[model samples]
Target: MTTSIRGTANADVLTRFRRSAHWKPLEYAFWCLPVLAYFAFPGNYLLLSQIAITGLFALSLDLIFGYAGVISLGHAAFFGVGAYTVGLMGSHGWSDPLLGLLLAALFAGIVGFLSSFLLLRGSDLSRLMVTLGVALMFFELANKLTRITGGVDGLPGITIGPILGVFDFDMFGRTGYIYSVVVLFVLFWLARRLVRSPFGQSLRGIRMNALRMPALGVPVNRRLVKIYTIGAAYAGAAGALLAQTNQFVSLDVLSFQRSADLLLILILGGAGHLYGGLIGAVVFVVLHDQLSDLNPQYWQFWLGLILVLLVLFARGGILGTAQQWIESRRQRTQARQRAGSTS
Candidate 1:
């Protein structure tokens, strides 16, 4: 009886997972917007590329905070590690973009894996402090290592060769934009698959109730560490993309502000959902661009006001609030149809 029950439960989980993973028409339309942007905004590829990179970074944070219920104030540590990885590699005549990105992800993953153990030891506050401390340490280390990192002056001479030896990164950012979009798509696809699987369901459970997960045979700490490490890799890849596309590296990559901005992006887009980060990135970047052009000094003030309004009125950021509204409308429509049929 126990074996049969367990088998049935597993089958049910698989069924739900598969159903969620099935792509919806809206998702297809969402992806088409990026391709459309290529023609719609021919001269804005540079900004678009930055948006893509920021989106990926937000996605990484979502993996940890949104999915795993982890709080990090220093996630930029991995980003810096990845940026420096690409910078160091390029400065040393290994300008292969792909290899640099790969190394960045690997090194960042290692750092994340090591630090995740510490994260498992603390409460949310402690975890936040630990993450912040780690980032500060990296920031100070980079500042001290002026010879390798160029410190406050920034890492120079980062020459990224043509991607795949064919697409040269042009000043117009045509190639860089495409490359970033491709990487974002591939990673997003993998993440979608991951979060729709049984593993992802367990994560949601753990997030809601960690102690209960352990009772259910889930190794809570191990799972957290794995997701944290993967999130680090994703951040590293984002950093690598920034470094490669911009052909420069700077201490700013490791700044607390970077992580804070990332958190803001996630909040604005709504966490826990995959599309939230991407959508948030687009809105944030465009807002920044337009606002800065309109009022460079007071843009932040306006941005804060907008955020406050959203938090008060939108409930679950943009996407989350939209989903809620859509769900409510659908329920109302269904009720109306059912009532009409009965009458």
Candidate 2:
């Protein structure tokens, strides 16, 4: 009787595990799309590479805002810091792309860690103002420090060496695209693991009710600081990739427009979901590319109209809407199955 009971318990555990594993197959298939795109559209590598970098940037934003409920408008600060770190290092003869990426991430992470205290002390509106202020400060600083950042003229003369001393960053952007995609996949995988962990659940709880989290023995502030720092590091790494791939850095890296655009991308893709960033980036970049070519003067107007419609109709963004639709279908099918089984 004891052995039979133990076996039944193990079976129940296995069933629970299998049920929880439903999303894994879908996630794996989603990742495979980029790889397939690389082979299908070889000539569009440069454009695809841009989309990958932008997607990574948006993903970092989603980490803090979507997952941790830390609303920041100055994410571009970390991004600029990362870009400048790589550009300045390359200009000074340390052209190793991998090293530059590491240094950039470290610098940005440190900055995020230090700045997180200020961010943690405020309401959402206050946080927004403070974050925007931080980015503006960085933008002005980069502009004033002409010798290092190159100011309005931009940071030129940046030269990135080959990846692992093997794959050179070619003019065609093949190496750059592959590199960005790989980094994105690795980071996304880590993020997937993180959001599914106990720590991630704590973050979600805090996001739902910060005041109640402290009562539950959750270290709310500490968790926020950690996720913020991690997000900053990811943003920095994305910026470094951009600088290395393009072989240049500009004050635009620190601009408010970049921050705003990133926020838009996150909203378009749907927050609180991992695939939102990737889907939003593809839509935004592709639309921008196609529309600008068609009517550069009025493209912004059309884009704005589209965004207005999305905001009104798709409350959860593209991915969220799609997920909801799929869920509804599954529920309907299950209901029918149950009805038939009863009959």
lDDT of 2 by residue, 1-343 (tens): 9999999998986686555535677787988888999999999999999999999999999999999888888999999999999999999999899999999999999988998888888988998998898889989999999988999999999989999999999998999999999988889888877876668878889889999999999999999999999999999999998998999999999999999999999999999897898899999999889888999899998888888899788889999998999999999999999999999
Could you tell me how far off, in angstroms, the CA of residue 157 lies in candidate 1 after the best superposition? Answer: 0.7
Instruction: Score candidate 2 by lDDT.
Output: 0.91
Question: lDDT of each structure?
Answer: 0.94, 0.91
TM-score of each: 0.97, 0.93
Tens-digit lDDT track for model 1 on 1-343?
A: 9999999998987787788989999999999998999999999999999999999999999999999899899999999999999999999999999999999999999999999999999899999999999999999999999999999999999999998899899999999999999999999999999888878888899899998999999999999999999999999999999999999999999999999988988989999998898888999999989999999989999988987898799869899999999999999999999999999
What value of lDDT does candidate 1 attain over all alpha carbons? Answer: 0.94
Best by TM-score: 1
Q: Which portions of model 2 miss their true places by more than 4 Å?
A: 1-23, 341-343
Model 1 lDDT at residue 65: 91
- Residue pairs with backbone overlap in model 2: none
Q: How many collisions between residues are there in candidate 2?
A: 0
